[model samples]
Target: MSVGLTQPIWMEMALALLILPGVWCTSWLVLYQDVCAVRGSSVVILCTYHYPETLVNKNLTVEKVMWSHGRKQFFDGPFIIDSNNRTHTATKFEYVGNKVHNCTLQIHQVEQSDSGEYAFRFETNNGGKWTGSNGAKVNISELIISMTTPKVHGPIKEGDCVNLTCMNNCSSAVMWFRNGKPLQEESSTLYLCDISFQDSGNYSCSPKHHNRPLSEVIRVSVEYSPRNTSVSVWPSSEVLEGSDVTLTCSSNANPTLNYTWFKIDGDSCLEMVSQAELQFNVTHTGNSGKYFCVVSNKHGRQNSTILSLKVKDHAEGMAAVTLTILLAVLAVVPMIVIVPMVTWHLVAHRKKTTAPKPDTEENTQTTEVHVTSPTSDCSLTEERREEEPSQQDEVPYATVHITKQRANIQQQNEEATAIYSSIWEQQAKEDLYSVVSRPTPRGKQAQDDPVIYSTVFRQ
Candidate 1:
C-alpha cells in the first residue's frame, strides 16, 4: 500500500509542474480598436502586454517579436515587423517599444495594402509561444474634395455661392488650398459667398497631418457680363467728310462676350452690326449722330456710354458746297458762250463764201437803153452766144432814160417853098423806101410833104 501511494504522488507532482509554467507564461494584449491612416503617411500602432513575473525569474527569455496583418489566427499571415536575434527584418515596419512587454509598431509611408487586422506573436527561449487573441484594425483612404451644394462643375456665375467638402477617413483637420497655397480657414467644409472672377483658380484639399498626396485639383470659373463698357472712335469725335471712320467696342467678360454695334435713334436704338468694330466711309451728314455698343454673354449684358459723332462743322460744309457750285458754273459758262459764238461765226462765213457774183456786161447794157421819140415805136434786142449763164455770170436788170431836142424854121412862101419842096420831095422819097412796104388806105391821096426824122442807137 505505501509503494502504490508514492507512485500516485509523483504523477500529481509532474502534472502540477506542467500546469504552473503554462499559467505563468500566459500574456494579455491591449491595443486600439481601429486605426485610420492616409496613404503616403506613417502610422503608429501602440500595444502593451501583461504577463506573470515568475516567467522572467525562471530564466525564460524572449527570443523573437513579430507583427502580421491579414489574418486572425497566429502564424497565418505574412509578418510585417519581425525582431529576431536582436535585429529587425521589415524595412517599412519598426519595433519602437520597450524590449520587455511593449510591442509598438511604426510603419513609414503606409500604403493601402498595409491596412488590415494586425496581431502580435512572441516566442520564448524555452520553446514557448503566444499570440494575442484580439488584433488591431487599420483603415486607409485617399484625400478628395468635391463641390456639394452646387452639384455642378466649373463656370458658375459671379455673385453666386459655392460649397466644398473634403472627403477623408482620417480624423485629421482638413486644409483648403487655392493655387497650391493654404487658406486661413480649416475644416472639412468650405464656403465661398459672393464669388468673383478673382476666385477662379485651381482648388484642392488635404489633411493637416499629411503633407504629401493632396486631393485632385479642381478648377473654378466665374462667368460674368462685360464691365466698364467703352467705345473709342479713331481720329476723334469731330470728323471730316469723305474720311474713313472706325468705331471700336471693348469690355471685360468671361467665356468671351459677343459685341453688337448700335445707333441711338430718337428714343430707341437701331442694331447696326454684330461685330466688335464698325467701319465705313463717311459721305454726308447722315453718318453723324449718337452711337453706342452692347456687349453681352450668357450671364448678362452691358451697354457703353452714348458717343456722339460730330462731323464737319456748318461753316466747313457751306464752304465745300459753295466751292462745288462755283466749279460747276465755271465749267459750264465757258461752254455756253463759246459754243454759240462759234456757231454764229461759222454761219456768217458760210453765207459770205456762197454769195453770187454780179455780171458787168448785163449791167452796162441796162444803163445805156433809152426812148428817143414818143410817137415813134422803139424796139430793143439782146444778143448772146450761150443759153445758160456761167458760174462767173451775174444777175441783170434794166433802166431807161429819155431826152428831146427841137429846131425852129421861119416860113418863106414862094421861093423858100420851091427850095423846101424839092428838099421835102427828096426826104419823102427816102422815107418811103425806109418804111415797111404796105398798101395805103383807099380813100387817102398821096401828097409830097417835107419831114425830118431823128434815130438813136446804143451798143
Candidate 2:
C-alpha cells in the first residue's frame, strides 16, 4: 500500500508542473490600461509581466522583444521598437528591463503621432511566443494655459495684477507668447504685474524645446477710468430769453460711463438730470446760472468745467420804452394848449391900452365931479349957451374956467379901476395853469388891505 501511494504522489507532482506552466503562460504580461502624456515631454509606462518557471529551467532564453502600435496580431503592425536589433529600434523609445518579467518602456520627446494603442511581443528559443493583448494606450495632449480666477474671461483694470498657469501631464519648460511674440519666460506659471491698456492682446502658451502644439488663444482686455472730461453748450453761453438750451458732457473712458447734470446753487450743487446731455427751454432771467456735469464709471468719476448762462428780460425793456414815450407826450401837450391862450390875453391887453380917447374941453366950470360906481360910464355935456348961435355957424362952446385938480382927480380914478380889472384877470389865468393848487394861509390873506376907486366929472 505504501508503494502504491508513492507512485500516485509522483504522478500528481508531474501533473501539477504541467498545469502550472499552462496557467502562468495564460495569465502573464500585465500593464496599465491607459496612459496620458503631454507633448514635448517624456513618460514611463510601468509594466509587470510573467513567464512559466519551467521555461527558465529548460534553458529557453528570450530571443526577441518588440513593441508596436494598434491592436493586431503579433508582428502584424508597424514596429515601434525592437530590443534585439539596435538598427530597428525607434529613437524616442527605450526598453530598460533585466532578465526578469519586468518590461517597462520609456518614450522621450513625445509627439501627437505617437498616441495610440501599444502592445508588447516576446519570442523564446524553444519556439515559445507570447503577446500582451491588453496593453497600455497613450493619449497625447497639448499644453493648456488657464487663469487662476473665478472667471476665465479677462477684462482687468489698469494697475491690477493677474495670474496665469500652464497645465500638462508631466513637468516641462513652458514658454509664453503675447500677440504672436515670445515673452522669454520658462516656467509653469506666469504673473502679469501693473497691467496697462497697451498690454491688451491675444496670448498663448506651449512647451519649450519641442514641436509642441500651442494652447488656445486667450483674449485679454484692459480697462481704465474716464479722462480729459469736458463740456459743450449748443448755440452759445450767453443766450437770449425764451430760447432752447442744450449742454453735452464728454470724456475718454474704456467702459461705458453714466452722466449727471448739476446746477450751482447759492453755496452747493443741485442735481438736475441723469444723462449725457441736458436740454431745457429758457423763459426768463431765472434760468441764468452756473452749471456743470459729472461722468462716472466702475473705475472712477470726473467732473466737467463749470459753465454760466445769461438771459435778457424782454418785457422789462418794452415797459421802459413805453414810459419814456409817455413822459415825452405829457411835456409836449401842456406847451401846445397853454401857449396860444397866453398870447391872446396879451394882445387884448395891448388893444385896450392903445385905444383913442374922447377929446375933452380945454376950460370948464369949476365944479366937484364924483363917480359912485366903477362900472358907470362918464361923459361931458354941453351947457346951454346964453345967446343962440346961427344955424349955419353951429358951435357949442363953454367960457368957464376949469380947475386942473378936479379934472386930474377924475382921470386918475378911471385909470385906477382899469388897472385893477387887468390885474384880477391875470391872477385867474395863473391859477388855471398851476399843476397843484394850494389854499392861501389864513393869517397872510387877512393881513393884506383892500383898495376901492370912484370916478366924479362936471359938464
Candidate 3:
C-alpha cells in the first residue's frame, strides 16, 4: 500500500489504449447518395472517408480520383486520375479537384456524353494503395420539346385558305418540321411561328440539349365547303304577272366564290336560270327548267348537280286559279242536282197547272138539275140547258195552278169552291214560269143558283 503512492505513468497510458479503437477510420466512400435533375438541369456527386490510425500519424494523403466512361461496357479499364498532382490528359474529359481532404471531382458544363461510371484510387501512408468499388453514375438529359400541327377533319371545298397552326406542349419549346426539314427560325423556338395549308405535311421537333428523340408527327389540313348552297327561283315556284324573270344568289361562300345557274328549257341547256338564281316573275312556259349551281373558289371551281325548279304557282296567280276551279265546281254540282229536280218538278207542275180545276160550274149545274129535276119534267129542261151550252163550256174554264210556291193558295180556295187551283209568281226579270188560277163561289149564293143541278154522279 505504501508503494501505491508512487504512481506509474505507464498505467495511465495503458488505460487510454484500452479505451480507444486501434485506428482512425478514413476510407474512400460515397458520402452523399444519388440525385436526380431535369433534362437540362445540373447535378452533383459527393465522397467521404474514414482513415486508419496508422495512416493518420504518418504523412498519409488521398492522392487522386478518376471516372471512366462505361456507357458501352459493364466494366472499364483503369483510367487517368483527375488530381493536379497526377499527370494525364484526354480529349473526352476534363476534371478539377478540391483540397486534399475534400477530394471532389468537377466536370465542366456536363452533357449527355458525361453519363457513365466513376472510380477512385488513393495513395496512403507508407505509400499503400487503395481502390474503391465501382464509381457512381452521372446522367444528363435533353430539354423537353413538344410540337403540334392542325389537321382539318372535314371535306375540302373551293376557296378555302386552309389555315394551320403549330403548338408546343406546356413548358416546352416548339419547332416546326416541314417536308422532313426544320426551318432555322422555327427550330430556334420550341414553338410554331405561323402556319397555312401549304404547311400541311408531317412535322416533328427534336429535344433540346440531352439526346432525347424527336416527337411524333402531326398533319394539318385546311378546307371548307360553301354553306347553304341552294338554288332558288326568283318568283319562287309560283310565277306572277308583270315581274322580271331574274335569278339571284343567297349562300355563304369562302374565298369569294362566283355562282352560275342553268335551266333546261325544252331539250336545250339554256342559261335561263342564270344570275345566280333564276328569276322569272313574269314567268311563262319558257322560264321553267333544270337548274344548276356553279361555285368557284380561288383554287378552282365546282358545279353542283342540276336542280329542276319549274316556275309555276305565283303568289297572286296561284290563289286565283284555285278559286276559279272551286267556284266552277260549286256552280256545276248544284246545277246537276237541282236542274233535274227542278225540271221534273216543273214538268209535273206544268201538267198540274194546265189541268182543269174540278168543274164546279158543271157540278152546280148538274146538282141544280138534279135538285130542280126532282120532277122528271125538270130533267128534260136540264137536258135542254146542256145542249145550249157554249164552245167555251166544251173545255173547262177553271184551270188549276199547282206550282210549289202557290200550293197554299190552291188549298185555301179548294175548301170554298169544293175545288183546288194554284198560281206561281214570277221570280224576277223574265218570267221563269206561270201557273193557273181558279175562282170559287161560296155561301148560299152558290146553293141558290137557279141553274144549279144535283145528280147522284156515282164513281
Candidate 4:
C-alpha cells in the first residue's frame, strides 16, 4: 500500500517557507534579508559566502569584497562599500562582517532614499569573480496619526467631542485603541464624544496589513470644571465650647481651585475660611448656624448645601453625654435582669417537662356532729358561732362537710309524714346548735373539745 499526503507538495513547501525568516541563497553565497525597514531606524543585512576548497586543483581564495546598489546592471553599479580601498559612499552604509564567510552590512538612520536593492561581489586569487544574485531588498515605511484640532487649540475640555484619524483612513473600518488597550470601536477615524477626565489617554489605530506598522501614539487630554462640592466636619457637630473643631470644603476641579466659607445670616452672606477646606474652629454658641462653602475656578463655581454647625457649653455637652450613657444603660438593664429570670423559668419549665411527675396529694376532711337537745338556745346559735371562729379551730381548722341522707318522702305513709311536718315546723323557727369536737395537732388525739357551731335542719 502507498502512503498518502494530506496536503500537496507545493503547499507544504510554501508553508515551510512562511515558517522561516527572510533568506536569499545561491550555491556559493547566502544572505540574511530583512523583510522591511522603518524610516529613522537602523537595519542590518547579514551575509556569508563560501567556495570549493579545490577548484580543478587550484585552491579558490577571496582577495577583495565589494557592495553596490541602484544601477541598471547589478555588478556594474558603483560600489558603495569596498574592503580593498576602504571606500564608502556615505557614513550611513557600513561593512560590519569580515571577509571570512561573514559579510554583514548595516545601515544607520535609514531614509526613504535608502529604499533600494543591495548586492555583494567578490574576486578570488584564482580569477573567480562573483556577485550574489538579487541581494537584500529593503522597503521603508512610517507610522502617522492625526486628529482634528479645536479652534481653541488648548487641551480638550470635559464634555467635548473629537475625531481622531489614522493615515490613509481607508473606507473600510479598522481597530481603534486607547492607552494601548483596544476599544470596541472599529474605524480608521475614531470618534470620542462627551469626553471626561478619565478618558484622557494615548490613542492609536491598527494598520490595514499585518506587515504594516501601527500608527504612532497620540495623547488626548481632558480638562474639567469643579463638581461634587462637599463640606466635612472634624470632631463632629454639636461639639462642646472651647473644644477645637475643624470644617473642610472640597470639590473636583481642574486648573486648581479656591475654597471660601460663608455664613448664611438671614439674607446676607458672611465670607470666612471655614471653606478653607482644606478649617474653622468653634468656641461658643455664636458659631452655631447654617453655613455653606463656595468652590470656584476660572472655569466655573459651585456651592455646597447648608451645613448646620452646632456648638454647646461644657455643661450641656456633659449632660448630653451623660444622658446618652444613661439611656444606653437603661436599655441594656432590662435584658440583663430579665435574662436570668427567664433562664430560671425556662429551667423550671424544662425540669417540669423532663423530670418525673410528682404524685398528687389527696385532701382529708373531718366532720364533728352533736345534738343541742333540740331545745336549748336554738335562737342564739348564729350569735355564738359568729363570735367564736378562732376558738372553734384552736387545734385544727377544718370545714365540716356533711352529705345529706334524705328519706324518700313519697314512699312515707301518712303517719310518718305528719311527724316530719311537725318537727320541720319547729326547726323552721330556729337553727339547731351542734357541739363540734376539734381535732388535735399531728400525733395527738382530740379529747372531745367542745367547739360550738350551727347547722340548719331542712325538710
Best by TM-score: 4
lDDT of each: 0.65, 0.65, 0.45, 0.65
Model 3 residue 210 CA deviation in Å: 8.9
RMSD of each: 36.7, 37.8, 27.4, 18.1
Q: Clash number for every model?
A: 1, 4, 40, 2
Which 10-residue span in candidate 3 carries the lowest summed lDDT?
Answer: 364-373
For model 3, residues 263-374, the per-residue Cα lDDT tens digits are 5666776554334655445446555556676777665666666555454446646778889999999999999999999999999999998998853322221111111112
Query: Could you give candidate 1's per-residue lDDT for residues 39-145 as a string of tens digits?
Result: 77788887776544444246556777777776654465567666753454457888787657787888788788888887777766655555665577888888777
Alpha-carbon lDDT of model 2: 0.65
* Cα error of candidate 4 at position 455, Å: 40
Better of 1 and 4 by TM-score: 4
Ranking by TM-score: 4, 1, 2, 3
Error in Å for residue 74 of model 3: 12
Question: What is the C-alpha RMSD, rounded to one decimal, of candidate 1?
Answer: 36.7
Pairing residues by index, what is the TM-score of model 1? 0.45
lDDT of 2 by residue, 1-459 (tens): 000001123453356457565554354444544677777677777765655555435655677777777776345656776776757745688887554676678888778998887777776675665667666788898778876533456568888787778877654677888888888777888888888888788887876754433677777777899888988999888676888999999998878899999999999989999999999999888989999999999889999999898766777657767898999999999999999989999999999999988666443333222212222123211331223223213222222223335457456433432211111221112211111112232444532322332121221
lDDT tens per residue, model 4, 1-459: 111112223553344335543311223554546546556566787777665454444666788888886645456667878877843557888988876678788888777898887777777785556776666777776646787756457778888888887653122445677877777766567788887888888887664433223667888877777899888788786787776867777788876788888888989998876336525457678988877899888789899877887999888888999999999999999999999999999999999899875464333435543333343344556766577554333322224553222343223321222211112222234444444554443543354233435454423
At residue 36, what lDDT does model 2 achieve?
A: 74
* Total clashes in model 3, counting residue pairs 3 or more apart in sequence or in different chains: 40
